[model samples]
Target: MKIKEIQDEIVEEFSHFEDWKEKYEYLIELGNSIELIDKQNKIDSNLIKGCQSKLWLYAELQNDKIIYTADSEAIITKGIAAILLRVFSNQTAKDILNSDIKYIEAIGLKEHLSPTRANGLVSMIRQIKYYALALNTN
Candidate 1:
């Protein structure tokens, strides 16, 4: 799917929950469901610096798409990474760079997160965009 389509799907999924508590529970479920990055990829170079908990993000270009893999010491952060990957992974570098990811706000995620977690989210996005910028071919 296109990035916008995936993001819209996420927004629709989150809309089913009645409250933030339910939303958080769903995020935790998402966190638990994902397979983590390979141990070899969990190097210091991949670690996101601003998060209170450790989050490692890695991206590589494959067939003109940027594939992402990540893990986090915190489940919520992991869930956030999973969501990002779902939207951006296997997409063209240009598509990743062009998508604004407004579903974050549409889903009411930013307001619900603690300040530190919000910063971590921003850092994660920056790192992904950095990868896209570096790998862009068009």
Candidate 2:
């Protein structure tokens, strides 16, 4: 789906939840659903840069698309990471680069986050897009 379509769907899905607390709980549940990466691929060197919490993000090129897996020391951060992964994973490098992630703020995730958390989320998105660029270049 296009990013805008995906954003709309997420907004519609979360609209049913009454508050940010429940939305966060739902996000945590979504995080738990992401497949865990292998221990060998989960090295500290793969950790996202600029995040206050330790966050490991691993990406690979498959069928000319990027597949990402991530884990975070903080639950809420993990959920945020998962949300990003769900949005960009399995997409072509061109698609990812062309997409506008700013919709995340419009979707209410960033608004509820603290300044530090919002920065961390931005860092994670940058890291993922960097990986996509590397894949595209190679």
Alpha-carbon RMSD to native, per candidate:
1.7, 2.2
Error in Å for residue 26 of model 2: 0.6
Q: Could you tell me which residue pairs clash in candidate 1?
A: none
lDDT of 1 by residue, 37-123 (tens): 889999998899888888898888889999888999889888888888889889999988888978988888875345465438888
Instruction: Kindly report which residue stretches of model 1 are placed more than 4 angstroms away from their true locations once superposed.
Output: 112-119
- Using Cα atoms with residue i matched to residue i, what is each candidate's TM-score against the true structure? 0.93, 0.87
Relative to the unseen true structure, what is the Cα RMSD of model 2? Answer: 2.2
Candidate 2: which stretches are off by over 4 Å?
A: 112-115
Q: Relative to the unseen true structure, what is the Cα RMSD of model 1? A: 1.7
Deviation in Å, model 2, residue 48 alpha carbon: 1.2
lDDT of 2 at 66: 88
- For model 2, how does the per-residue alpha-carbon lDDT over 1-138 read when each residue is reduced to its tens digit? 765677677778877988888988888897787656668888988877677778888889999888988887777778777778778888888888888866577667765345565437777778888998999944
Best by lDDT: 1
